[model samples]
Target: MQPFMNSPENYHILESLDSLVQSISENQKEFFQKVSEIRDNHYTLVKSYYEESRRLIEMLKETAFLCSLMFNIQDEKSICASAINILRKLLENPVAIRILSTSNSHTKLEILAEESSAAFSIKSLCTKSPLSCIAIKTCRPIIHSPLESAVPCPEMMESPEQYAHICFPLIADGVAFGCINILFEHDTDIMLLKRNIDLINILAGYVSLAIHNNRLIKTVKKEALTDKLTGLPNRRFGMEALQNEINRSKRYGHVFSIAMVDIDHFKLVNDNHGHTEGDKVLTLMADLARKCLRNVDLVARFGGEEFLIILPETDIDKACVVVERFCRIFNEASLSDVLNAKNLTLSGGIAQFPHDGGDVLSLLKAADERLYLAKNSGRNRIVAGKLN
Candidate 1:
């Protein structure tokens, strides 16, 4: 035996083992390359998603400012439109459809606005949708999967694919004003919505405050222009309206008339029956004037026991007829008993654009001069037309 270790058989066996080890090393190198490529692709996807998220957050901030602008201008329609536009932008990914829901006084959730592609039809949610009810009642965010639960409405089931639904309640000061619903198509990253929950909540806050402030502004404006006692436009508003009508007449060449009406023996009634009864009489007169005038006419309280009426598209002749009818109606009404007097009557003076005088001041002066004449001529009568 010449050195068994140097035998050809043994050498061949050693060569085979070395070849097997080399093949295993090559396979391991190829596997690592595949893993490295997969990791690079994942990182690229993550970077793209992050950039998109940052863009959406910037948009949300801009939307908040837009809501502020709409509130400042008191444009309710623009507010809704702006909200829809911002929502469409923010929900580009994951979201296939969006719906804005507002609670009506009738205790029903009304779809105020919506934005969606043509492939999808916007449908009303079920009245008994538990998820929506819960979100509203809790004033918090609710998320659910329509495929796993029955929370989805019939419209949501149209796709029959896995989808995520989110509802964010528009709440401020513990009051739920409304909710925003977002529907996500299949394979959407639920994490995206989760990450933006805080931003969405902030947007909801902005919307709620805008709507509340707008309503408050409207109420204040209405109160400022209205007479507290008689519920008619006050003298300030009347003056402004007169100026507007003057401009309109000048621009359009349309005729309009003004009547300055005074209550006869009004001071005596106030002195005898007290200011409370006087207030009642004023309110009664306002109601009578509003009821007797045409829908196009504007009646306003000029001052104490005085009313200014604007008759658009009417010449002096038609204005006189309207005023005469009002006089007859007031004289025949049962207001005499309310005033505790023998007769309650009105004295009116009429002035027409271009006919009596041009411009607001001229027309007002001419009407006032005639009103003076009516008071001097008789306690109950009308003074109209030019004086020679």
Candidate 2:
């Protein structure tokens, strides 16, 4: 009311204020939209992570089951089956999943699992896919960089698509065993894929541990049943082994023989050279005995200075020939080299099963008594025995 002239100025000011308000409103709308998008992306990531975590937990449980199963499995076929089931579950990819296996002796950075379909896919891309080498080279868990922007496949290389894959090395005891390869049908975002590498490492560690532990347990069991001193089966183990062989032979209607072996003057050497040297002499004798016998024969140290040899699929006559050969070999042992002894010799007593005795105890007793007879027969001869 005081100044009409200033009204124009006020109007201009109002117009500027309106424009600022509109600009502010527009900016707020854009900010909220961006925030919503971020939340959606975050939710998707979290969901994927949770799903993968669930899969991992299930895989670990299966590993536990496998651990228990391996304890009793002696044959190799069962081992393969258990491992395959686990891999299929872990990969769960439409692409083929392959497990690359290695031994304790194999010491190369390797993939424990592979999808040959990656090879096929890459080959389809350039007829020469570099996928195989690329997978082999990275040794890290995943490879997704070249996917969004892929190059031509190498001629020597072979894969079906311009796709990349995840490669995890299966390692144990600081040894690179092999790798497990996982390929996706579609390209995955690199950063997200890379984040899962830690989980892959965890899986690889478990795989290595399971395989190595199983193998170690089997080896330890074998060593436990074997005599370290004589490279033979110990008394208890031999009896057990003999029982198994006997059962097999009985089932097949085959014949087998058991022989009791006694070192002729083992005590004299032990008495002269102390137990340590005595141990060495015993070891040497064991090696000699093992060398003298057939691969199928089961020889064991029954006790101090005594051994048992079981010949499968053999009757009395055939048993005699083998026993005599072992006797001759024992007599010619290089005891002098180890015990510094003037001479070394062994005597054996032969007992044919189902002839000398029907049961384990009876056969063992008959063999023992015959062993004494061999000592009486002249400390270095085989005494073929009939049951007392």
Report the lDDT of model 2 for residue 192: 57
How displaced is residue 37 in candidate 1, in Å?
Answer: 8.4
Give the best candidate by TM-score.
1
In the predicted model 1, the residue pairs found to clash are none
lDDT of each: 0.76, 0.67
RMSD of each: 5.0, 7.1
Give the lDDT of residue 356 in candidate 1.
84
For model 2, what is the alpha-carbon lDDT of residue 74? Answer: 51
Which stretches of candidate 1 lie above 4 Å from their native place? 1-53, 61-73, 93-134, 150-166, 172-174, 181-196, 336-342
TM-score of candidate 1 on Cα atoms, chains taken together: 0.76
